[model samples]
Target: MELRYSPFDFTVHEDPYPFYARLREEAPVYHNEKDGFWALSRHADVLAAFRDDRRFSSRNGIRIEEPFWGPQAEQFFSFVAMDPPKHTRMRGLVNKAFTPRRIAALEPRLLEIARAHLEPLLEGEEFDLIDFAAKYPTDVISELVGVPESDREQVREISFAVMHAPEEGDGQMHEGSTDAMGALIGYYAQLTAERARRPQDDLLSGLLQVSENEDRLTPEEVIGVLVLLIGAGSETTMLLLGNAWHAAWKHPAERERAFAGRIEDWIEETLRYDPVSQSSPRTTTEDVELHGVTIPAGEKVLLLSGAANRDPRAFPDPDRFDLDRDTGGHLAFGNGRHHCLGAPLARLEARLALTELAATVADYEIDEAAAKRVHTSINRGFVSLPTRVTARR
Candidate 1:
């Protein structure tokens, strides 16, 4: 089949994996002339590109196309869009705050947050998982980043606005949402300034307290990192959680396996089987040859995480959602220096969310017709999922 991949194409959203399989098998280094980007779909190529950061640089920006008309990577995305040693320096500054121990300490608080969102649904048989997925992570990440509970609504509102930048017929970003970006950054500036002054017991305060005696990120950098964390941790985890629930509803055997004694396995398989973060975009620093094709330097290359996760060469029976298979190699979280820092927290949230969900429902029926997939090229998950639960006695 002829290959064409458009980030704005929502038709592919419903079942892109089938198309992704075709990309991996037929055109591993698929190029899109209209949008002017290359896609690396095979698992091996994606992993290699991720490891060779020197060749496939992230400095330009992560999105295949710039999100706006102006400068983005440096100002908007913080370290994610920057390469080392700048990436290294910035990550080192914030790394202390996101350590496993720090994230583990939030378990009690995260559990509290999850339960707060899930409690109301326990009483009702017919409810949507989207509400729980959307609310829990935003609150947890907000509290962790020092956004006051009162301001979380504003933070989340701005985040959703930014993530859903209006798509033109070509699937590129619309110009109108620049104000949302300003609103988000301006909000973070106020929060960071407060955290610096008061020194709250939160991550933002922790970043501020980093010794200014040595290498440290600027105030703007701190705000940039915090803003990225708020949006990345919230919506992505919501996608993971919603996808996990959707997987369980679709595959009864996997649900039974999770409830029986393999919740983590179920989550891992769901990540591989139906990951939310569908792709990671990188720009080639120089001309590079791969899979019999040489992509010129400076071109944007999309690592199809959703496609690579299901690459049959790496994953046997890639289409089947089987908890029995090993998922350690999955690129749901990209590989190497740029691997997602919030992965531990996202995984923790998924485990807690799924464990609670499995324990609460004796069985659940998903209203597939009512399920609304979020319309975006980057992530794949639901905006709404209507499910009817049979509470366990």
Candidate 2:
């Protein structure tokens, strides 16, 4: 069989690790002409690419799909799709508002949110873990961003539409997605305007007020940040919870350990073993030669972090989901200046949510046959994880 890799392929979405392994061994610099992207599969290569932002520019955005791929990618991805200077300016302002203190303060609220969602579900005989997984992070992010509770379900729905890809397609954003994106932006724009008018203690108002020597975020930039948070802040964390649950269920012994209070290790191992973010896209600033292949300048490149995380050179016995292993230096949250800003928040949410789950539920079983994976270009995780938990008395 010919070796081919496409982020858009449903088969690849089902399980990309096998293909990633082959790409690492056979073609470390694998190219998919159909998808028009070159991929780096090895850990060293992917890490180097992540750290070498000058060579592998983020200007073209991290997604290969249309509408989200070009110069206007900043509209969707915010500073994530930007090169320095612009990225520096925007990120600096954002840093002032999205502070560590703000995130730390949310810990108590996060626990409350987690228990609020998990406790009721534990009372039921059978429920979808994804229900709690999706709603918990959505509420956390909404609370941080000052979204009204009444509007959050609609926000989550629009975010789902924005992230969802057609099961069968050429891997392009559908009209529904585009429309949803518009609605999301419009919604945030209104929110930004309202915050400008009446400042609140939420992150949105923080972004509006935050300044660096008289340089503050514009209204458009604030809205862009809010929209970016929906995907990066809310959607990714939602998927992370589902992936962690599924990974533990697949490894019963490890699951027992996780249930025995190895929450941090379990979260770390799950991140490396089966990361929610499988791959991230970049564009080459200049021609780069690697492994006897010359990738031309200005081409799409995918840093296959999923494959990199499992590379044996970096992690011994990488396939096994052992909670005891040291999971440091994983590319799960990426590396370099473009590393995920919301990583701390994501980890905190996972820790609090899973810890609460472990406290309330003695055991749980996932209905593997009934579990459904979300169809998306970049993310990989369950959208419907039917589960039955044995509640702790």
For lDDT, the strongest prediction is: 2
Question: How many clashes in candidate 1?
Answer: 0
- Against the true structure, candidate 1 reaches a TM-score of 0.95
TM-score of every candidate relative to the true structure: 0.95, 0.98
How far off is residue 232 in model 1, in Å? 1.4
lDDT of 2 by residue, 1-393 (tens): 999888888888889999988999999999888778899999999999999999999997877778789898999899999999999999989999999999999999888888888878888889999888888887898989999889988988887787664544476777888889899999898888998999999999999999888788999999989888888888889899999999998999999999898999999999999998888899998999999999999999999999999999999999999999989968998999899999999999999998888888888888999989987767889889999888889
| lDDT of model number 1 | 0.83
In order, the Cα lDDT scores of the candidates are 0.83, 0.89
Query: What does candidate 1's lDDT look like per residue over 1-393, in tens digits?
Result: 466667668778888977897888888899888777889999998999899999998887655444631246767678888889988888888887667887898899888888888989889889989888888888888878878888988887787777665666465666645678788899889988887778878888888777536766677988988778766788899888889888987898878888876889988998999998889888888999987899998888889999999988999989998988989999998999999999999999888888888788888889999998876667889888999989989
